[model samples]
Target: MESNKSGFEPKNIWIARRKKQLRSAIIDLLNQYHEVPKEWIDEYNNHTIMSGSIIDTIIIIKESSTNCYEVQFGNGKSGSIVYSELDYEFQLFEATSEVEQVILCRNKVGLTKDKSFVQTMIDWLTSIGFIVDVDNGLRQTT
Candidate 1:
């Protein structure tokens, strides 16, 4: 196997470069999403997995009846709702812990359909080259 000047295998170097590209693409996607509030981006930029504080997963639950969206930021084990939107109007607030957030989301959208909501987001992330662990939510795959 060929090695680079840094003594790293070529395959390892390629993998590292690919991971960087995927991370950049995911960040770009988040920034372009209108529903993601500026505060979330600010917070994300200030932290990282290395610091033990990063927005590991983003759960967007859509209330079918009201056509509203509840956006939550998950850090693997727990999360909180950071933003919500209805009728094209949105509000930003940090309320409730992951347990409460889950109950609220279930009450609004029901548990039976919640997987689809999360899976859809996961699918999109995968399509964009971001590796996701369905069981643990999003993390720094690099």
Candidate 2:
């Protein structure tokens, strides 16, 4: 097994690189398809994407005090109730054939805390040409 400067195995490094590519593609698609605010996107790119964290999902929320948006990664379960007012949330997962499966939710504050949000996400994913299954949250059909 080959290792890079970080000492990560070749497969691990490849996975990391692939995740970064997928994250970029998802962000680009969001900008293309949605009317997302530039500040929100910028924060995600700078704080979340550039941080090199293996994030399963990202929640962009508007801070009540600052009135500015920020990126919160992971499952979006932790944080104060006020901070949980999510403006947007998206999950990126690997799919077969280099295409990434994306599950997106928008404009629902505290949506992540609700168990029913899974069904909501499934409905949205199916509407946009992704197949949801028990094992994999989503998969895109070629």
lDDT: which candidate is best? 1
Q: Where does model 2 exceed 4 Å of error?
A: 1-9, 34-57, 60-72, 80-142
Sliding window of 10 residues with minimal summed lDDT for model 1: 133-142
Quantify all predictions' global Cα lDDT against the true fold. 0.40, 0.39
Off by over 4 Å in 1: 1-5, 8-19, 27-47, 64-67, 76-89, 97-142
* Candidate 2 per-residue C-alpha lDDT over 1-142 given as tens digits, one digit per residue, 9 for 90 to 100: 5545885566655655765665566555543433334454344445444457533443433333432223343433322112223455433332223343333333333344453544454344444443222112112211
Candidate 2: lDDT over CA atoms?
0.39
Number of the top-ranking candidate, with TM-score as the measure: 1
Give me the displacement of residue 44 in model 2, in angstroms.
14
Q: TM-score, each model?
A: 0.31, 0.28
- For all candidates, the clash counts are 0, 0
Residues 54-102, model 1: lDDT tens digits? 4444554333234333445454333322222333222222445544433
TM-score of 1: 0.31
